[model samples]
Target: MHEQREFIPLDKEQTPMDTPKRTIWIQALKVAFPHTIPILAGFTFLGIAYGIFMHSLGFHAMYPFIISMVVFAGSMEFITANLLLGAFNPVYAFFLTIMVNARHLFYGISLLDTYKGIGKKKWYMIFGLCDESFAINQSIDVPKNVDKGLVMFFVTILNQIYWVVGATIGGVFGYLITFNTEGLEFVMTALFVVIFIEQWMKEDRHVSSLVGIAASVVCLLLFGKDTFIIPAMIAILGILTLARKPLEKGRVSVQ
Candidate 1:
């Protein structure tokens, strides 16, 4: 044959922008409006309680207004005034708050590889990985041509709105509101119980719940309430790590 050169063609499909980006703001509003209503309500109540407690402890409304902006954990915000007043030790507060919210560590790990290339948007998303955002992201099936980063961004924005509104308005509600807060702290425990029940219903894994309860009980009994969280987390992690091989071998659909 007359000399012919082989030619390779470039694949034109490599660029992501060729596909349409989903209406991120619209999808965000869709998810935020309905899903965030209850969040706003609960955080309002939580923040009101926090404001009342802080006021009772001789602090201004602005104390919670600021802390809620900075340390936005749902449960941790409630106890922070006490922790700060009792110890005034940032080190203790830091460890104690993280111990209480250690589950976020797992959430962060799950999201670590997924949030890549988020550009300047990465900073706030990391800070805003609160309970609601984690829950929303956990359930989403990333839509076609839509970015997870944007979803996370919207989730964070939505959550911060709720928290800020809660914090800023809580004092007004607190002063105008009069209710006995005796034992109301149980709301935090109840919230966790509800979340656990929801997760359990979604996943339908008896072993996970059993292991969690068992580890929590064992740690609480051994280490006492304040210090037990660290050990409980360790126990939970150890058991889950051990189950990884079996879970993978069995091929459960969980990510």
Candidate 2:
């Protein structure tokens, strides 16, 4: 006689709701904080400088805070500072902003696939996609156990905090502040390098990465530093378009 076996569910893992909301947020913050350390140092100093500069220009402390919160772009905010001193011209300012932030176009294109299905947080991600934040978020592969959205959100918020706080403090106490902060800018470069190496190590095939490096180098050599980015972006897009089928096939085969 054949024996009967007991039936059991294949997968009875804990769902997200099973965990406490506080625990979930705490975990996300824990994962996200280390990545923002460099930003903390860099943005704090830079924001302070920006705040002091605005104070020197006779603007109120609140000006730096409001601009830091609203504009959020370091270079653009600096440009806006100069623009504030100049004659009023909204039309010129509009085009100038576009020119200053044109590189974001490439960033948006590169992130299209990755940003899908992220829900409402996607808008904030796009809004806060500074060079450092994008580098960290796109390079990171969120672990299966953690919430990707929360981690990214915290990263964005923390970076902004460093900048805003610095700017606000500097603006309020510009007269009292007198200290050298020459090398703090290097933190941003170091952060990018770390992220690049992490991404390089994680990839099974460095085909696309190599292409990016090669194209960037070639364009930089040919076009000079100030105008090579657009060409490099175009080259990357073309190369990726041509390689899409093979890349997709390799991904499928691996899966």
Q: Pick the candidate with the highest TM-score.
A: 2
For model 2, the stretches where C-alpha displacement exceeds 4 angstroms are 1-15, 217-227, 242-255
Model 2 weakest lDDT span, ten residues long: 6-15
Best model per lDDT: 2
**lDDT score of residue 44 within candidate 1:** 62
Model 1 Cα shift for residue 218 (angstroms): 3.9
Error of 2 at 89 (Å): 1.8
Tens-place lDDT per residue, model 2, 1-255, is 213433221112333657877787788889999888889999998899999999999999999999999889898998899999999999999998887787788778777766655557778888888887878777766677887777887888898889999999989986786576778788887887787788888878888888999999999999998778778888988999899999887775453
lDDT of 1 by residue, 98-135 (tens): 67998789778877655655656768888888877776
TM-score of 2: 0.82
